[model samples]
Target: MDEVSPFAEVLGQAIYQFTLIKPLLPTYGHLLVSALFPIYIGAHASLSKPSSAAKSPKKSQEDGYESDTEEDESLGDTHKMESLAPSDALMFPLTAGLTLGGLYLVIKYMGADLLNKILGYYFSQMGMLFAIAFLKDCFAVIRSFFFPRKYSGSGRIWKPKPAERVFQGARDDGSSSESLEVRHSPLPGILGAIPLPHTVRAALWTCREVAYWRARLRIHVHRLLHAECWLSVLDLLSVAVALPAIGYFTFVTKPWWLTNFLGFSFCYGTLQFMSPSTFITGSLILGSLFVYDIYFVYFTPLMVTVAKTLDVPIKLLFPRPAGPGEAPDTISLAMLGLGDIIIPGMMVGLALRFDLYLYYKRKGMHKAQAQGNGSDIVKPVYQSAMGGWGERFWTRSVTPSEPELEPPYHDARSFPKPYFTASIVGYVLGMLATLVVMQIFDHPQPALLYLVPGVLLSLWGTALVRKEVHEMWEFSDAEEEDEDSSVTDAETKEPVEAGKQVSLFSRIFSAPKEGSERPPKSDEANDESVDGKSDKKESPEKLELFTISLYHPRKRETSKLKAPTERGQSPEDDENWALVGTAERDAEPPAKRLRRSPRQH
Candidate 1:
């Protein structure tokens, strides 16, 4: 044969490499994508506040700013944010162990065929709902990235109207309101100056009316489809595409790509809705599952059997090369459970939140120090960009006049994520280790055996190096304030001094008694006078007499006394008379006042 041309040689080499790489590409690609789930989920969770903790609409309106909770409400999201407690961590593994044991017993006696059929039907239905939600979220995320919602009348054009101008003029001149007959310009700008022909003007006017009406129609459609229904045009189209795609996967075909797609959606949904409240809780959860995974995989056949038998989106499947003597058309597959990803992923996500908490806490401290009051530090609130239902599908671009709101420490995407970075790095390494061991031994491995250690050690090691062990250990995303205690605090006491250290015992037992002196107000409160001198003080004896007179009881006959106003009298009105009569009673001794009757008055 003649020497091959340079082009032919290059083409042959390229084809050889691609063919060699093709089998391994999907395996590694899926692994890489799965690794990233935690960071994304964690970052998103940190950025979002609990719906219950979100500001009330009245408070938001009073502050002259709308809150993200309003948008969450409009979206019809009822799933409250839940954090895994230590108790949950302890109970979870026991539950999983019991579930695995049950499944193993059923499979041993009943056979895998019957179990798969029942599970397949159930998962298919659940998968459809999850896929739709996943697609909707994707649309929202993409739209938000490209065109974020505007605030403060931003991105809106001002077209000065004659009516508004006249009203403005009247206000400026301090004159009574008057109607001014306004003349309309047939054509505006260059067209007006050009003095176009009547036919041309009429054509332009007709076109303008048609364009206006078209815009009006579009607005109505948007309101009906998106604003009221909370379903966008894109969302409707995606649902149309998704239903067919899902049906094809369920009935017509069960390809690896479709399976992976549905599996990824399920994993994402799990991460989105659930998380560990703290690093410790995450550790407990991961550690428990780590042993759980190893024991089930090595000591028993439950995990492997269930994973193989379950024909659903509970696990990601990657195609492997056919073994020797196998037909080229025959496909072999490798599998990774959703639990492997979601479990370590939860810990990694918690690490990301820990990073966020540290960042915000440090920022607040620095600001307080800069203001010369270290005790005045307040955690900066995270503001979410999600807004009205209309903006979910479409948003206006930010105008020069209206700049986008800058988050305190920049957005979640760009924030420093050392803990998240470490955990994810550990996760990737663990996954690679699992693959390597599997290839060498020719046996499947329990992924969490490597993953849990990798993730926990990486996070704990970083915390140790950074000297943030205590902070990391104690940090939690759950609301710390007790609602009942807050109400009690409000009713029974003045605002506590910011920097003053008070013991729990003191807080419980130091409440002011009936005759005891009140705690002194803060210096700021005391310094409110114009000349900075304290207000005049009443004598202790006079204060005591006034206090005693206010507590004197009156008979029900007092209800007969009516106010001069025709408005219905209240119990408060009778109390007001009691207060007025207290001045007269102050002249008498305490015993004499008590002996007096309401009928004498």
Candidate 2:
């Protein structure tokens, strides 16, 4: 909670007030689920909840996920309400009082504006990226729905008519669940080519065969991402596990503290065939988040407060230009004092080591077993690199040390994001890739022309990585078994209830019914005004804020009492103020001033 990413801190404000995943927290929870936070980590963490199905990864005891289940059950039963003893509520006031007081000191006394601004810029960019991603997906969905023939690979370009109708989403026996055409791509002649854009055609050719380049990108990207995520997880786990369960020491850096783990993800991604730009770009982003988390816990409140005291914008330290008449938004350098450094430093150190422990634990567990985890289990490297199950199993059993193919498949996708997205986010991202390549090669920047690659990449990803583009299915039968499992349903389900109570309105209304009218008391209703003539009316005090100034000095000034200036100007004195000019008046009793006022009139 303390070491949250700044991106999250920025996005958290809006997200918390709206979403209800971890319902108790406000926007802080939202920041907990931002782009900087590799979605898989949190999503996978949530997966540890008690599953009815067996094969899902078991929850670690230290994580409190298991305890959460019992607590939820205990909390849900209305009969237990009476059992809430005095002790439970006793500390509540202390926690609340301290929390509010701390927040006030941080916001009012310290300074929150500076922190808000830096984070705001980062999160705004995050929001834009998300918007682009959403638009891409929307376009894809539309193309699929409207121009199914063109979008589906079996269109005029690739279509090879089958003797029988395909009735897709139906039984293999050709029974119709929904009527659909069945056709295969007409294998174009070796010399033949399609009329798509050159880049698109090249990408299509590269990826369409399902052989070399297509799978390489996927494997490499996954390896890079997974390794990096593991690094982050280890860094965090060091602190998390130690503090809560095992006694944590004040010091907690890994023995060889050079951060080599980040490279694991990138290297893995590269081996899998993900774009180098992607590996680097994703690393840059997550790296920022990691640093931000460390920084916020240590410096943010102090920096802002110190900046205010100094009457300097916190940003001035970074030496950026300031606009005229604008107050500098500053975070205080003073905040990074000794205590700030020590406490958070310890926490971060512990987090890193904890992740290392976890990796070893998993490895140790695998060692304890004899037959080894099945061939189907994904290795840390992407599967596309090596030969499929049979070749791998036989090789391992016979001459285990001998390497088979040049790009031996590693079971893991280093940064295993959902396939469809990895395939396509490439299009818009390809532009970024080109920039990186140019920068790396010290070449001229491609302007409009470089956009060609993005378009090409997009089409390639779209055709090959679309929903149901399960190219690996043929190679790994384990996936088919997983699809049939209840675990899959739980993973994909929109319903938040994990075999627990679900809101009636959410269950009934949000379900994909043709027309479901459940209740008006939804989130939208919550946003409505609070009843009666107006959903809300400004509190009487809110309409106008009044200020009263009392004089308790040795000099008595009865007539000096006067109403505050209307529009910040007193009717008694007619004066114009200028830039760098002061507003001043002689001290006098109101009676005395009243008598003297005739001269002014």
Candidate 3:
């Protein structure tokens, strides 16, 4: 005992700490899968536009970017330029390492009491972030209602109108000016097209018209009474109610489900607002996190300690029931971080959406074959209702307006079911594997280490088995080319040619402008600008082009992340679009999206 070395003492302490984990692992084992279920369900069902959709030119104006001064543009440009240089991929690792290193030094030199202060500050900051997330979720719901199907390039609040021929056919301005048309009616045109009995159709039409007029009346009355004032009042009232409720739940009552629900809402809404654009990008991000989680949980004490002491809803917890003869309400909880579920679940959702797209493409392929003009088919609107036999016959399906069908010859073999099947199975297996390791070692392990490998293995292994590795890796080439063609054709089109007004629903989901406040400048203007001789006076064609760019959806193009820029100045514009476009690639098949099962959400 007197001759015991320092190394032996440290080893003894490590063994002692590890020995204590045996009871803890068994206690939490029952909670592993159930705790993760909600996130799994929510993320899989989360249908969101690409994050870039938020930057849509119309959205920019809606979000108050229309009033942005020249100073703001200058600032944005500077920020954009700064972001253009390639940065370190390991930035997160470096920042985390430094912060933790500094904390360690402080704890070792100063004392545990000082460490408590730092942790308290950290948790406080985290709570504020959570609160902000809650607010964002609330606002997201509002935006979704106002801008339905924004992510899928459908349902914009504003539609562009071509110049109306006025008196003498001469407008005040020499160049034509476009006006925005607001869609006041909430009902679909497909409702009118429904193949119901005349009496039934009349009743439905009456109901819709009555509803629309009622809304119009309400809007008019609200405007007469200053709607903005009332809205501000409502906002204040909401804040007043929210603060007390938040405080009561967070501190006074401290209900687990309440906090957890809020946290889940935040995660769900945020993920829905900003989604992964591609399978590969999703995989890469998940892979990095897998490594991060393993290192933090296994190699260091930080993750566990922070998780336990933080006492926040960042992780979901499920309380397991007591065994026979034990206390009835003993709280043995199983816990999982939000990230573990969300990251993998996103891939599942994308695969599922891809399955729907492929299903339509398969149908469109048959239709294209029958029509006998697959390659040059500019617009193929397929209307086949899905549901109960009578209902299918009675109701008309709403067809997506853009993205013309691809030919059968170029159609790649798509096995969407396998991707989804493998991902879900791998997730469950990975969860079980994580528990098994914990049970064996009697220690905490990172769930993602198993989860990431499980998902990757399942996805890639299924691809390999189906001999679709290359196809899946290079999925949607035809779709991508079509989208590209649409964008190119759109840029080259005469504005007057774009005057045909699409229905409201079509305009919403149709590709309007990509990004930017102003339309793309013509090559002549571009040359002039380069030579310092750009004209202040815009040609009618340019005006017409701008109007077309603003209002018209690109022909045969699917919804993509990159459209056009507002001012066409941001350097990061293209790279950012590329990153987000990958997420939206799967959502663009020109067919009615299958109505999601209520149970899934």
Give the number of colliding residue pairs in candidate 2. 51
Q: Candidate 2, 118: how far from true, in Å?
A: 9.9
TM-score, per-candidate, Cα-based: 0.58, 0.18, 0.45
- Estimate, for each residue in 523-598, the C-alpha lDDT of model 1 and write its tens digit: 2233233224332343333221222222222223322433343546344333321222233235434432222111
Q: Candidate 1: deviation at residue 39, Å?
A: 5.7
Q: For candidate 3, what is the lDDT?
A: 0.44
lDDT of each: 0.57, 0.27, 0.44
Candidate 1 — which residues are off by over 4 angstroms? 1-26, 35-46, 50-79, 145-231, 385-409, 480-601
**lDDT, residue 118, candidate 1:** 76
Better of 1 and 2 by lDDT: 1
Give lDDT for model 1: 0.57
Over 11-38, each residue of candidate 3 has an lDDT whose tens digit, in order, gives 9977875675555555455455444554
Better of 2 and 3 by TM-score: 3
Using lDDT as the yardstick, the better of models 1 and 3 is: 1
Residue 346 in model 2: lDDT: 20
Best by lDDT: 1
Query: Sorted on TM-score, highest at the top, how do the candidates line up?
Result: 1, 3, 2
